[model samples]
Target: MILLQANQVARHFGGETLFQHINLEIKDKSRIALIGRNGAGKSTLLKMLAGEEEPDEGTITRTKNLSFGYLAQHTGLTSQKTVWEEVVSVFESVHAIESQMRELEKLISLESEKGNHADSNNYLEQYAALQQTFLDSNGYGIESEIKSVLHGFRFFESFYDQPVNTLSGGQKTRLALAKLLLEKPDLLILDEPTNHLDIDTLNWLEDYLQGYRGAILIVSHDRYFLDKIVTEVYELSRHQIYHYTGNYSRYLELKAAQQEQEWKAYDKQQAEIAKLEDFIARNLVRASTTKRAQSRRKKLEKMTRLDKPAGDEKSAKFLFQAERQSGRDVLAIEQAAIGYDDTVLSEPVTLHLRKQEAVALIGPNGIGKSTLLKSVTGQIPFLKGAAKLGQNVDIGYYDQEQANLTSRNTVLEELWQEHPTFPEKDIRTVLGAFLFSGEDVKKTIPLLSGGEKARVALAKLSMQKDNLLLLDEPTNHLDLDSKEVLEEALIDYDGTLLFVSHDRYFINRIATSVLELSENGSKLYHGDYDYYLEKKKEEQEVAEMTASKTEAEIPAASSAKRDFQQDKEHQRQKRSLEREIAALEEQLTNIDTHIAELQKQMEQPENLEDHEALTELNNQLTAQMEEQDAVMAEWEEKSLLYEDTY
Candidate 1:
C-alpha cells in the first residue's frame, strides 16, 4: 500500500528552483535512499516529504491513519528526564491503555459488589474491547521492544540512568534514533544516520532496519551502509530527481549508461537540426524553392528541441608525490603506550611500517587510534616507549578538524602563506585545480563549509611534498565525489600512509594492510578490509570451538576409574598430536610474517634497482611459503584423525 505520494512537487528558495516537478511515493515497508552531493538540497526535500516544510507548488498526500517520523540530520534531545525515561516515553499510549484497564477493573468489581448486574456487564464489555485493542498493538511487549532497539544502538544498562542532557552529542543522536524506531511510524525518514555510528553499531542498525515493518527513506554518504540496506536509489542532481532500481553501486552503473544514452540522443538531434537549418538558409533566397523552404521552416518550428545533457560537476584533481624516498623502514614504534595524561588507552603496541605501504587504523571510538597518531607526530608525548621515523622521512598530517586552518585567513592566503616563496599566481593555479576559482578563493576559512575546509587541507598537503603522511579521518564532511577523488589520489601516492577511518569502502579501496587496534594490542592483516573480516571470523570460530570442547568435557566417577584410565590413554595421545599441530601452526605463522616482510622490502627503490637481490629474496619467500603450506595440510589431516579417535 502507498502510505504517501507527492504530485508535481517543486521547491524554490529566493526565486531559484531547488527542484521542480518531482513526483514520488512512499510505499509500505519500502527501502529507499535519497542520495546527492553536498548542498544539493537533499535535506530540504526530506523535510518537505515529512511535512515539516511545504513545497512551493505541489500537493503531498498521505493516506488516512498514516504516521510519519523524521529524524533530521542534526537532532538532539533536550529533556530533564533520564535516558531510560526519554526512551520509554515513546510508549505513552501503551501506558495509557494499562491505566484505563486498571480503572475499568476497579469499576466492574464495585458494580458487581453493589449487585448492579446491568452496569457490571457494561463495564466488563468496555474492558474486553480495550484489552483486545491493547493486545493487537503489542502493548504488553513495549518495554522489551524498547530494550531491543536500545541494545542494538549500543546503549547498555549503565547508560539508562544517565541524564539525557548529560550525554554526548553522538549519544543523544543515537537515543533520538532509538526513540524513532520504538515509535514505529509508518514512514521513517533518516538523514545521515551513519554519521556517529561505529562499525559494530552500524552493522546492528542495518540488521534492525532490514527487519523493520515500516518504510524507510534515508540520506547518507556511507556507500557501504547504503549498499547493504537500500534497494532503490533516488539521486537528486542538477535540480532534478532521477530514480535507479538498485543499490549505490548499481546506481552508478545505470547512471553512467543513462548519461551515455542521453548524450548520444542529444548529439543525433542536434545534427538533424543543424542540417535542416543549413538547407533552409541556402534555399530560402531562391524564388522557386522559397515556398518549400517556408514549409520546412514551419516543420522546424513545430519540432521539439532536446536540452543538452549536463555532465558531472567539477572534482578536485591532485596527487601525493613524495620529494624523496624514505628508508625501507618508514616508521617504527616499540613498546608504545598512547593516551592523554596518565591514562593509558592501549597496551604496549609494536609496529614496523615499510616504505610505500598504506595502512588503515580502525577500532571503536575513543579506542586511541587518533591518540596514537598524535603520539607518533609529537602532538602529544607517548606515555611510554619510543617511536622513530626512518632516514629522510618528512611527515604530512591531515587533521579531521582542520585545526591548522586559521579563521582569519582567506583560501588563497591559507595555501600561499604555507609556502611564502611560491608566487601568488602559482598558488591560485593550485586552488583552481581544487575547484576554488574566482571569488571562491577570497572566502575566509571561518565562512567556508566543512567540505571547502577539507579541500583547503588537501591543497596544503599536496604542496608539502612529504614522504610520510599520517591522516585522521580525512574523509569527514567530504562529499562522495570528493571522497572518490581523494581515494584516487591516495591510491596513486608514492609515499607511506597511515590513516584512521571508519569508512569501510575507503579502507577496501586504498589499504594494502589493516592494523586493528584494540585494548589488548594491534593485529596486522596483510590484505584489505574483506580479508580482515574473514580472518576475524576464523578466529572467532576457533574460539567458539575451543569453548564448546571445554564445556563438553566430563569427569569419570571412582567406579569407572579403570575405564577412564583406558580412555585417558587415548586422550593423552590426542593431546600429544594437538601439541604437534599447534607447533606447526606457529611455524607457519612465522613463515607468513617473514614472507610479508620480504614483499615489503622488494618494493623499495634500492631493492628494485638490484634485480639479483630481489630475485633471491623472492625465491627464499617462495620456498618458506611452500613448506608452510605442506605443514598446514599435515596439521589438518592430524586434526581430523584426532577428532575421529575422540
Candidate 2:
C-alpha cells in the first residue's frame, strides 16, 4: 500500500527552481534514504511531504489516518521540562484517558456510599470503558518503554531528571528521537538524525529503525548508519527522483552500473548514426544512386537520435598541488602534557609523525581530542614539553567549528577571500563544484545552514596547496555523497593527513593509523578503524578466555608454586632485558659507524661543495640518530619494568 504519493511536485525559491517535475511514491514499511547535494531541495521535499510546506506546483496525497513524525535537524525542546517529563509528554492523550478513568472510579465510589445505585452503575460502566481504552493504548508499559529507549540511546539514570535544556545538542537530538519512537507514528522523517549521536547511540538507532513497524526516511552523512538502516534509497537530482532498491552501498554499485550501461547505449547509438551518415554521404554523389541517396536521407530524417547522458563530470574530481616535501620528521612531540590552564588531563607523552601517513585521533567527547589537535597546531600551549614541526611543513587546517569563515562574508566571498588570486569566474566555478551555485553563493555564511557552511569550509580547504592537512570532524555536516567526494579527494591528496572524526566509515576509508584516547591515555594502532575494532575484539576474546580458564589446568601444585614460578619469570625478564640492552647498544654502534663514514665523506675537500650530497647525508644521519634514541629509550623503559617486577 502506498502511504504517500507526490505528483509533479515542484518547489521554487524566488525565480530559481529548487526542484520540478519531481514524482515519488513511498509505500508502507519502506525505509528510504533521501539523498542529494547540500542544496538539492531534499529538506524542502521532506517538508512538503510532512505538510509543513506546500509545493509551488503539484500535490502530496497521503492515505487516510496515516500519521508522520518529523525529527528536524534542529530539535525544539523546551528548557523547563525534565527529560523524563518531555518523553512522557508524547503519551499525554493516554495519560488523559487514565485520569478520566480515575475520576470515574472516584465518582462510582462516592455514589455507592451515598446510596445512589443507578448513578454508581453508570459511572462503573464508564470507568470500565476508559480502562479498556487505556489497556488498548498500552498505557501500562509506556513508562518502561520510554526508559528502555532512553537507555538504548545511552541516557544515564542521573540524566533522567535533568532539564532538557541542560543537555547538549546531541543529547537533545537523542531525546527527540526517543519521543518520536514512543509516539509510534505511521511514518518517521528524520533529517540528519545521527548528526550529533555517538557510535553507540547510532548503533542503537540502527536497531530501533530496523524493528520499526512504520516507514522511515532519513537524511544523514553517516554512510555506515545508512547502510545499516535504510532499505531503499531515493536520489534527488536534476529535478527528478531516482529510486534504488537497496541500501547506500548497493545504490552506489547499481548506480555505477546504470551509468555504465547508459554510456554504452549512447556510444552504440552514436556509432550507428555515424555509419548511416557515412553511407548517405558516400552514396549521395553517385549519379545512378540518386533514388538510394534520397531513401537514406529520408531514413536519416526520420531517425530518432538518443539523448546523451548528462551529469556534472567535474564535480567528483578534486586536485591539490603541493610544493617542496617536508622533512622526514613531519611532526614530533616530547613529554607533551596538554590541557586548559594549570590542569593537566593526561600524562607526559611523546609522539612522532612521518610523511605520506594518515592518522586519526579518536576518543569520547570532552576527553580532549580537540585539545590535542589545538596543541599539535600550536594554537594552545603545551603545559609540559614542546611540539616540533619539521621544515617546510604547510598545514591546511579544517577546524570542527568552521571558525575559518567570516560571518559577514557570503559563500562566494569566503572562497574568493581564500583564493584572492583566482578570478570571479574561477571562484564561482569552484563553489559550484562544492554544490554551491547561483544564489546559494550569495547567502551569507551566518545565514547558511550548518551543512552548507561545512561545504564552504571544505571548498576553501581544497584551494590551498599544503603538504599537511589537519581535519577535525571533516564529515560532520556533509551528506554521504559529499563525504564520498571528500574521501576520494583525500585519497588522491599527496600529503600527510591527521584528522579527528567520529564517523566510522570516514575513518575506515581515510585513516591509515588510529590513535585512541582513553582513560589510560592514548594508544596507537597501526591500522584503520575497522582493523582497530577487530584487534580490540580479539583482545577481549583472549581476556575472556584467560578469565574462564580453570586454575587446575595450570601445572602448579599449590599457590606457593605459582608464586615461585612468577618470581623466576621476573628474574628471567630482568636478564632478558639486559641482553636486549646489549643488543641495542651494538646496533647503535653500527649506526654511529655509518654516520661517521657519511660525515667523513662530506667533510672531504672536494665533497664539501656538493650541496645535494651534503643534504642527503645530513638527512640520513638525523633519521639514524632519532631511531637510535627511540630504541634506547624503549630498552631503558623495559629494563626498569623488569627490575620493578623482580
Query: Could you estimate the TM-score for every candidate?
Result: 0.81, 0.78
**How many clashes show up per model?**
0, 0
Roughly what TM-score does model 1 have, to 2 decimal places?
0.81
Cα lDDT tens digits, model 1, 199-222, are 778888989899889999999888
For model 1 the local lDDT of residue 535 reads 87
Kindly give the stretch of ten consecutive residues in candidate 2 with the minimal lDDT sum.
312-321
The number of the candidate with the highest TM-score is 1
Off-target runs (Cα >4 Å) in candidate 2 are 100-136, 285-287, 320-354, 381-395, 408-456, 459-467, 539-646
> Candidate 2: lDDT over CA atoms?
0.81
Give the candidate number with the greatest lDDT.
1
lDDT of 1 at 326: 65
lDDT of each: 0.87, 0.81
